[model samples]
Target: MSARSIALDHLGGAEAAASLVSGQLDDLLIDTDLPRPGTIYRAIADRPVKGQGGMFVRTPDGPAFLRQVKGLAPGQPILVQVTGYAEPGKALPVTARLLFKSRYAIVTPEAPGLNLSRGIKDEDLRDSLLEIAHDALGGQEIGLILRSACADADPDAVAEDIRAMHDLARAVLADAAGQGPEKLVEGDGPHTLAWRDWVEPADVACRPGSFATLGVLDQVEALRRAEVALPGGGSCYIEPTRALVAVDVNTGGDTSPAAGLKANLAMARDLPRQLRLRGLGGQITLDLAPMPKKDRRAFETALRAAFRADPVETALAGWSPLGHFELQRKRDRLPLTDVM
Candidate 1:
């Protein structure tokens, strides 16, 4: 979580309140109600009495949350915009600095990077940065949510946000180097929201104050056909992992001659596309039971031919000493299965 403040010169409490409600303020600005002779103000709503600081408000659509402070002394007008980075080193270092119209809250990391290649270690780098940023903000308002908080988030979406934040930070830092703090990064937040709106899947249904689906209908329709149709009586159990995803196939009651090795090979061949649609990568092992001896060679031949069409880099090998025909699919980002 993060907070920032800006002095809106000549804008009275009513005007500020309107701006907050109308989404004009960089974030929801909380009025401190400082009395001044020429500054006429009125209470538009029964705001919290004690803390002049506004409660945390999630920045429209981004993964970020924000708080606002108001009521600077007359003639001492200033604009402040504070942003909190929650993803640690994953937070784009350069983009986070540009989240303000008056001034950025602070450039901070979300967390220490977890070195996957090395032994697992946890370091609180973002915590240290937030502490520094809080001191700069005069200890008035601060909020924090650990990166672990985003555990269940869609990995693809998070990757995109991180990319965007990094890009914005880079642009701002470049300009600031030449112009100092004279210019402010503006409207980046709205653009982030627009990007999310455009990229979100069509099948997702968003409701107020509730979890919504990710994709739109149009985006999901194609996926519906991507599923590998199980034979008359087989069922599949999916197991996902960062390295690779494994799907278990049980040839249930549908032991028809039609469900022979040739038919099974055909189905397995068609599976690569569905796997791709799910953005599956790394190794995929399909455990299939033994078929009638007569069809064995034919099944092997067909399976090889089918795999030839897959866009993903794949290898189909024989049922192992363990009776599993292993297929390895290369990984890029998080698999689409995890995203969906």
Candidate 2:
């Protein structure tokens, strides 16, 4: 995917914002004033609470829990990165992996094989990055993820920057070790970093009520609607339950056999786009208008082709005995409605 447009709309609350990328509602950022997930913080290690899998840490934001730690003791300063937000009535999940995120790369000292860049497709560029990271780390195991921005950047510049980032991460780690309790080192939230890497700054144009003008607000509202009209004459009813997302395709008022087939084909093409745009995940059951058994294979082929551009991993499990097409997509994050 090429660089896309991004717009940040202030939600009238402190540090709260809504981000739109490529005309899609990509992320919702809520500011709790506490370090959001993906942030690295320093805290004073405390004794593990009884029955809890993680140890307690005294942070500047408040007392937080480090879910994954080793060789830690009370009063010892520890470095932890927030991996997950505190669920309702739950403690935050943190880890010892210190991450340094830039617009084009993510550097970490713990994971050496992890590469997160989606933009570097050229083999030479990839090799160059690996060599640079290897040299910068001085044989120390580290992880580097190059973002889309690095796809066209100068290799030398990227190498220098990665080296600088490595040094910075090391400094931070040293500081966390030396600094005493209650000190917090904040890092960028996941949403902020996502927008930074995916959306080009030059393409951004901020305006009042931009979200509404760009149809972001309307698109979100439409996701909650039960039915969506197709291009030709059919309609699709989407019902998301606890078990899975059920989608029923109907011919509406068009009763002709040809029209029904056409509508089914249109629904087949549009369903995957809808799923991606809405960020719907998990098991999906597409109930199309019943057709001849011979035509099912052709319809399945078309359906698979429609999902060729989807970034999320999806698998077509073939049609069910009841004639519904079954599919499952990996869930990377919560649905749009739940996040909103």
Candidate 3:
């Protein structure tokens, strides 16, 4: 993965734009202008008030509700991440689980354990990266989640990113203490965080009509076309309900001997991408084309491998008795459809 050129084009409407770029053999339709999942913000802590699940603080953006967490006081300034969008006339929910985002890796204050390489498959290299992050942070309570881009990055580069995030967290805290109520210390709005220090100057570019013309339009099309055609001759229909997201696959006209197998494999690869691109999260049920019992194990293995590449944490619960694939992905923000 070389340094790819990124151009931001604002379509027309407020903050309407998309990032057009070819990466890893795929054309990623990223909404660069919108506040995405995992973005950090600086907010003033209002008087803590009891809420359904936790304490709530009113910020300039909106009301940010949290659980009964500590280390907070009324009139105190703090940083938060947009966990989910609030319903109309409802309070927006936020989390203190700070994350430092970069193209190469994401640094979080939460440490699940000593396994710094929680998702990486290579045991030896995992241990090595873990040691690097540990040493770079100097025992700071933080963890690193290397992005797919790190697969080709140098060890030194990874270490540098981890250290940078640690420094960034300190800077954010210092900046928050002096910030006025509802004033943005970083980023374009109180909902977003600025990464001007970490972002390479040469990598940034501006273009008009990128968001409005491309991102918003693409989002409208994706929601309208709930059913998407697969690579070969199959199709997958996405149904979003209040309870969970359900996807059903059909092997259109491909009646070959391995039609079911092929469709299932294609779906395994495409579904994760679709979920990320569309910002779909929480429980998901995939109804794949039926295959022979003997081949079921292989199908599951392929599905797991495909999902392993997702940036978010996903759990595959294997196949259900109804022959559907059950899974869950962590929800960090509103779905793309809702954001648009």
Write model 3 residue lDDT over 119-169, tens digit each, in one string.
467777766776776787798665667654454468898878777776876
Best by TM-score: 3
lDDT of 1 by residue, 1-340 (tens): 1122122221122211101111112111112222111111111111222463432222212222123434422222122233222222221101121231111121223232221211112345444433433343344322222232123334444344344444444454444323212223333332232222222122211243111122222333444333344645564555665555666665667666656454466556556545644555567777554576567667677777866855346776566677666776554223433333
Model 2 steric clash pairs: 112-142, 117-146
**Per-prediction TM-score:** 0.33, 0.64, 0.65
Question: How many residue pairs clash in all the candidates, one count each?
Answer: 22, 2, 17
lDDT of each: 0.37, 0.68, 0.62
Mind giving the per-residue lDDT tens digits that candidate 2 earns over 81-114? Answer: 7765554455566777777877666786777674
| Model 1 worst lDDT window (10 residues) | 35-44
What order do you get sorting by TM-score, best first? 3, 2, 1
Worst 10 residues of 2 by lDDT: 10-19
Off by over 4 Å in 2: 1-4, 11-102, 108-110, 113-140, 154-157, 160-191, 197-202, 256-273, 276-279, 293-321, 327-335, 338-340
